[model samples]
Target: MSYQDPAIHRYGQVIGLTIAAFVAADLLWLPFSNITVDSSNGVAVIIAGLIAGGYWLAGAVCSRMARRSRLSKVWGAIAAAFENIAIFLLAFIPMSVASCLFMYLASSTARPRLDAYLVDADKALGFDWPSALAYANSFPMAAAVLVFCYAALTWQIPIVVLWHACVNGRRRLLEFCAVLFASSVLTAITMAAVPVDGPYLYFKPAASLYDHFTNAGLSHATTVEALRSGPFIFLISKTVGITCFPSFHTTLGIVITYALRRTPFFFPVAIVNALMIVSTVPEGGHYLVDVIAGGLVAVAAIVGVRRLADHGRRIRTALLPSE
Candidate 1:
C-alpha cells in the first residue's frame, strides 16, 4: 500500500498522539512537580517530552495537509484523542509508577545477595565491556539517536495516522490498547518479581566506558552531594544504580516495533530500534542473560496482549450483526 494511504495516516496519528500526551505530561506536569531534575531522572522525562511533542505536532500538521472527508477527519480526531487518553491512563502513568515501585522493592529484597554476587561477578567480567557500554548508554549517544529517530518518526506518524483514518474498517484501536495494557501489566509484574541490578552495576562496573560516562553521572551525583541533600538524592542515586538482569531498552524497543508492525514506515524504524536496543548490551553494560530476558519479556507481552484482543474481538463479532 502507498505510504499516503489513510489507514497508515490514521495509525500514525494514534501513535503520535499517544507519544505526545506522555511528553506533554512530562513537560507540563511531571518534571518540576512530581519528579526533581537534580538527578538523571529528569533526562528521561525530557527526552520523552521532546519526542512526544515532536510526534504530536507533526501528526497534527499532517492531518491538516491530508484534508480528508469530514467523517474521516472526525474519526481520525476521535481515534487520536482516545489513543492519547488510553496511553496516559493505561500505559504511561501506571507503567511509570510500577517501574519505580518495582525498582525500590527489588533493591530491598535483592541487596544482600546482590552485593555478594557483584563482588564475584566483577572479578570475573572486569569493567572494560561495561565501560564501553556505559559510553553507548550516555546522554550524547541517546540524544543523537533520539534526534534521528524523532525526525524519522515525525514524518511517519502523520502518514500512519491518516491511513488509519481513511481505510480499514477493523477496530484495531481497541486491539492495540488491549495489547499495550496487557504487555505493560506483564512487564510491571516481571519487573517487581525479578528485579536484578543489571550485570554492569552488579557484576562489574563497565570500567572503560563507565569512567567516561560515569563522569557525567558522577558530576551530577557530586552536585547533589555538595548540596547536603538527604533522602531525595539517595533515592535518585539508587534509582540510577540498579541495572539487574532485564534490559528495558530491548523490551520497549520490541514493544514499539510490534505496535507499529502494520505500518510500512515501521519497517525501517523497527530495524533501527532493534539495532539500538541490541547495542545496549555492550553499551548499557548488560549481560547476555539480560538481553535474552528482555527479549523474552517483549515477546510475551506482545503475544499475550494480541491473544486477549483477538478473543475479545471474536466474542464481539459473535454477538453483533454485520452491517
Candidate 2:
C-alpha cells in the first residue's frame, strides 16, 4: 500500500478506537446511574449508520472504477472523499452521543458546580458578561446573525464534506478529523473533572437572552438538573451541552476554521467562527473563562495531532520506501 493509504487508514483506526472508548465508558456508567436514554437516540444512531454505510458503499464502487479506469487519480480521489465523509459522520455523530451520555453522568457527581469560579475568573480578566449580554440584546439583528453563526458549528459538517470531496486532500482532512477527536477527548476529560452550571444558569440573564436560550432548544440547564438531583427522563435526541469549563462551541469554531485554512472559504469561516465564539456567552451559556480555555484546548489539540501525524509518518518512512 502507498504511504498515503496508511495515513488515511490510521486516521480511521484512531477515530474508531476513540469512539469505542466512549462507548465503553458509557456502558460502564449507565447501569449504575439513574440516567436513562430514550429510544429516539438509538433510532437516530441507526439512521446515521445507514447514511454512513451508503457513503462507504459509494466510495467502494468509486475505488473499483478507479482501478479499472484511465482517470485513476480522479476516481481515486472521489473514492477517498466519499470514505472521508463517511468517516467523519461516523466519528462525529456517535461520539457526540456517547460524550453527551458521559456529560450527564458527570453531572450526577456531588462535586460543587464551577459557575462561581468560572465567573470570578471572567471578572478577574475584566470581562463583564452580563453587560456584554445586555449589549448584544440591544442589537437584535446582530444577535440573530450570531445565532446563525453559532449554529455553524453543526452546519460546518456539510461544509467539511464538500471541502474534502472537491479538494485534493488526504493528509489535511485526516489532521482535521484527528484534531476534532483530540479536542473532544480533552473536552470530555475536563468536563468530567469540572462540572459547571454555566453562566446563563448562574447569572440568569435577561428575558431576551432567555428567549434566545429557549429558541435554541439546548436546555442544558434542564438536562444538568435532571441528572443532578431530579427525576427526569433523558434521551439522546434531546442531548444538550452540559460541559461549560471548556466551551465546546468555541473549540469547534476554532478547529473548523483552522481546517478550512488555505481554501477560499477560510477567511469567511474565520469571520463567522469569530462571531460564533462571541455567541457562546449568550447562546452557549458559557463563561468567558470557558472560551479562553477552549481556545487553549484547540491550540493544544491542533499541535498534538500535527506532531503525532508527523511522528507516525517518520516511523513509516523509516520502515519502508515510498512507492
In candidate 1, how many Å is residue 250 off? 0.8
lDDT of 1 by residue, 177-214 (tens): 44444444455455545544454444455455443333
Per-candidate TM vs. native?
Answer: 0.52, 0.87
Question: Which one wins on TM-score?
Answer: 2
Clashes of each: 38, 0
For residue 202, model 2's alpha carbon misses the true position, in angstroms, by 0.8
Runs of candidate 1 with Cα error greater than 4 angstroms are 1-91, 114-178, 203-206, 209-243, 320-323
Give model 1's TM-score versus the native structure: 0.52
lDDT of each: 0.48, 0.79
Backbone clash pairs for candidate 2 read none
The sequence of per-residue lDDT tens digits that candidate 2 reaches over residues 98-171 is: 87787788777768877788778888999988887777777778878888888878888668667865564656
Q: What is the lDDT of residue 5 in candidate 1?
A: 39
Residue 173's lDDT in candidate 2 = 74
